[model samples]
Target: MNTATIDTSPIRILRRPEVEKRIGLGRSTIYLHMQQGTFPKPIRLGSGGAAAVGWLEHEIDAWLHEQVSKSRVSSTRA
Candidate 1:
């Protein structure tokens, strides 16, 4: 493996509070979007007895970008 050629982007995990803070959406809204297949689903963590969930930072960033693009397009049309 060529270390210099490898992709080195860090995998950041964002919990519900952080995700909501970054996206400016509440917990129920986020879950609603997820259920509607309009948002990226979280990655489940921890064991069988104690499970946790988090979203990939990159995925959330991508979703944000898409929203921005849509907003720009809509505004330009208006």
Candidate 2:
């Protein structure tokens, strides 16, 4: 018998565009949620950089899971 395993280490750091595509959210909406403290805050990839560029794949995955749980709870209540 053979089995498959998954690697769970935090690897990829997705940029804003990739994150928007993955989460189906607009640029403004993403920033809005972040301001509300309901989303993962991006990390600084470099020092003294004008453009913000950094994100943890794990954090995004966790946010997705939270959204799924919220949906499930709302549906159960309805």
Candidate 3:
């Protein structure tokens, strides 16, 4: 017998405001980074002609960690 598979991972989505709070960036900067492909793009949270969008919590966390890592690495080379 075959059964339907389900994803059990804990997924937390953050809205634009929360993202800004966590990353300490303004809305325009976030959009700018997204346009430049330097930031994680938000995924549509609403369907059926809705425009709501949010970012995956883990992606934002990873981006923050990467920024810190890059800053440290760059400083060490000086």
Candidate 4:
């Protein structure tokens, strides 16, 4: 019998467009946040490619949680 193993990594890389769609932000907005160091840094997918890609899904999820918490806190204060 033969068996195969599957690899599972916490990081889920996404293309620029897909990431923008997922975050509901436009291309410029995405770049703006990146410039502010508030967004995940993209990883180079190739040595000489013009396209940019990135991962750290866990980080994004954490960011979402933080936003939710902030919203709740503000509502409670108001």
| TM per candidate | 0.87, 0.83, 0.85, 0.67
Candidate 2 per-residue C-alpha lDDT over 7-69 given as tens digits, one digit per residue, 9 for 90 to 100: 767588999999999999988999999999999999887778586776799899999999999
Tens-place lDDT digits, model 1, residues 8-75: 78899999999999999999999999999999999988877569999999999999999999999999
Scored by CA lDDT, what does every candidate get?
0.95, 0.90, 0.96, 0.74
Q: By summed lDDT, which 10 consecutive residues of candidate 2 come out lowest?
A: 46-55
Model 3 residue 73 CA deviation in Å: 0.3
Best by TM-score: 1
Between candidates 2 and 4, which one is better according to lDDT? Answer: 2
lDDT of 3: 0.96
C-alpha lDDT of candidate 1 relative to the true structure? 0.95
Candidate 3 runs further than 4 Å off? 1-7, 48-50
> What range of 10 consecutive residues in model 4 has the weakest lDDT sum?
51-60
What are the per-residue Cα lDDT tens digits for candidate 4 across 35-77? 9988777788776667556756666667668768989999999
- By lDDT: ranked, best first: 3, 1, 2, 4
